[model samples]
Target: TVESRAIGPNMTACHHSYGRPDLLVYCCPPGFEKSVPFVDFELPEPPSPVKVRRPAHLLDESFIVKYNKALSIMKSLPYDDPRSFARQAELHCQFCTGAYEQLNYSDTPVNIHRTWLFFPWHRMMIYFHERILGSLIGDDSFALPFWAWDIPESMPMPDYYVDENSAFFHTERDFSHFPPRVADLDYTTDQNHPHRSNDEQIDVNLKFMYTQMVSGARKTELFMGCTYRANDGYCDTTGTVEHAPHNTLHTWLGSSLNPGREDMGKFYSAAKDPIFYAHHSNIDRLWEAWRKINNRRLDITDPDWLDSFFFFYDENLKLVKIKVRDVLDITKLGYSFEEVDHPWLNHRP
Candidate 1:
């Protein structure tokens, strides 16, 4: 598994690119070494008051204030600090981009995207991120707001993030794609694509969400993505949700004028934007929603997947090694999404 290979001695940074092979995107953390021994992850006793992640658009003023303050604190920390916002964003880059390679497998990059590792890997990433934010604000129950793009009324970029003074704001985002401008879930980079009215776009988005979550994803592999191993090369067969609304929203929010769509469009820079977490929070919520949709729709029961692990710096600055099985239940990790109307639940296209 990638975990065993990654923890090996002599682990060095791997050179790689995002879209174009020539356009190298270097995101490896400075002063990284394999000398720090990783402590095995242990599931915590269920949180006393499980943090409930709310929709970004529906977040109350007090909650938004707290959220902004937490992010501000995170951003103020020195870049070298593992719990700093800078390093948190770089963590995503290191994994999604080819910044690390399988220890014994020569030149074989370890990427969590486009494979079964996608959901579980990201779930763990944000779990720690949320913890860091809550810790910064001195509130253990603080939760991240999710960009509820799947719903009709909450479709556009949340207004809280649009505030220039808020910590959620990212200047690199597409100004034209700001709030009130309904998002195109099927959005592509093609400039010539026709535009739709707000009502029309919302209608289309609901249908797209329905297809990705329901009829299109019936099996565990189809919903979560294909199997990926430590020695395997890139596995491009992304799950239905990851391919459409997940990937499309990234492109939709990113600045199209920028070279590689800095901030959100590219994996290397996606988490740099505060909205990235909210967006992924929704993706993570969809994973849970998908599971409840059908009794047969379940997580992959393969040992390789259950045993696969990733390293993360917790809110306490402890370098902990977490396994895939550890994050299977959000309640165990001390968080859950707020209940909301799933308009796309029955809107089968």
Candidate 2:
């Protein structure tokens, strides 16, 4: 079993309802000062003609090539460099593995997954990551791709990630899930559902999407999750969708062969894989689609939800603190998900 280090003065103890042991996380670690020495409070100006990220399956050869090049460069940088692949992956570890404390509530750890911080915190993480990747390749308008795994036609891992030579390729993934093989979104490590035919699988997938994305998320709290306040103990309530498809996909992608399932199955190592970003892009896209369902089904407008904040290092290596309010608009952030068909809207199981 994986165990976190002892809880320190700067850590927060987490409580869960899943019968798991309490977890202690580092919300902010010591010595890793939160800012770029030269930069002030605000982040540097974003590049003009902001990129419109599209589905990984739909990307052309040139974009794929450039994308790999950018990743390769990122991976080759020094481990100490904040923008390096190792350092970038550590950011995920820092937040998820208990490396930092909640700013004012240092004794209370920061757990972004089960609380309202999941979506916006990750959106900012990926935003800065995308920017850093683009800056490495001198492409101001470059964008990351979303894995359109919800669609039957795009369910398998994108071919770009399977190529052995591609920077996106990670040998740690479950090869049994390689393309032309569809992912089981509702997959569980301990349970097995009898195999279904392709048509049957698509039907199941669509119905599951509808159930998780719509029916299961009818209320604001049910959708965005419970709030985390300063000095609060570990957040135990996870939103419906975040608990379902979002968590399901993570376990589904982790290679069973690797102990602790580094890079995908576990939170601390998930970001180590390039495909993790695309996987999350899809999750982020679902958040966008959910809000557009109707006037009644919108994001939580709670003041506590909007005012919550998280910190991250920007492309320029500047540590910036952003609020949930700042990212409610993706357009203002200068990026958007490529439009795609929502086949699950009417697939009411």
Candidate 3:
């Protein structure tokens, strides 16, 4: 219902000091300094409702194989193709690294993170990403599998993404955190923390989720994040869930050998990794779950927040525009998270 203004101007490209040095090679596009009209148009409604997107850890072998095959087809596409895997990944780098400008806002930079748009924007992102993969495999019902890392048993990287021969595999992830190794939910760059037993770690993980999901994020602003209006420029705050396990996992999975933790560790390169989509799918599910907590939590209602918009190339590689409103009802998009045990909902400590 709401249309987005032009994306803001390209901001100065910078790098996080903690990231690998080699990643500096990526720069804003040559003519990206000038504003370009982001094509805006409505897409025809889907012929049917979206499919049920399931957790990566819970996927059957058939689903896993189909998922991998879709990715393989996407990866095999020519890089110059808008729907190609390389172009798909580059969309992350460009938007995140300050390549576009907000429309009608004097070219102020428009970064998706650290603001309310983070959730809806990313939802649209993976939505199109899933569509692209599905179209490539000629399976309109295909959906992306989420990484349900909150579950203790599902903490390790899903085997579907780790096989070396799989197009989903990326060598940059932390080898020490591989399967048979549970994730440290509160992990930081700090490497000196004393190791705890698997039982102890799982206990710690559950407690962290309890605190983050219930205690820490009890309201809209606290849960979804601060608002960003036109001319607000890049956001200064990040939402609660986006801050915790979301970021911690990114840093933990980053490759030690690659500069700036190619693919997973940094925003500019994260989408390059196939696991990035899975990780985000889980994050998206958390948003749905967050709303059902006590039936008190709800999405923010600010018009500016609701009006925010973003663009993505659909499965057909045709440029299409989307608004934050389009994603509020995932069912309309024809997708829903697979039902999983919500042990964290009952956790109190």
Candidate topping TM-score: 1
Candidate 2 Cα RMSD after full superposition onto the native fold (Å)? 5.9
lDDT of 3 by residue, 1-349 (tens): 7654433333333222212334444534334344445556453378865678887777898888898888888888886677888878877776665555556553465777777777887888898898889888888889898899898878888987778988888887878778877877888766797587777888888888988888988778777877777775565687788888888888778886765555688887788889999989999999888888847447676667766776677876665767776678777778888789877767779
Specify the poorest-scoring 10-residue window by lDDT in model 2. 11-20
Model-by-model lDDT, in order? 0.84, 0.75, 0.75
Instruction: Compute each candidate's TM-score over C-alphas.
Output: 0.94, 0.88, 0.88
Residue 326 in candidate 1 has what lDDT? 89
User: Model 1: how far is 74 from its true place, Å?
Assistant: 0.6
List, residue by residue over 1-349, the lDDT tens digit for candidate 2.
Answer: 5332222222232222111124333323335554334332343356577678899889999999999999999999987677888777767766665455665555466667787778887887898899999999998798999999888789888999989988988977788778887878787777566676667777888999998888988877788777666566766688877887778777778788976555587787788888989988888888888888855446777666676666566777766767777888788888888899989888998
Which is superior by lDDT, 1 or 2?
1
Descending-TM-score candidate ranking: 1, 3, 2
Clash number for every model? Answer: 0, 9, 15
Better of 1 and 2 by TM-score: 1
Question: Positional deviation of 2 in candidate 2, in angstroms?
Answer: 40
Best prediction by lDDT: 1
Worst 10 residues of 1 by lDDT: 1-10
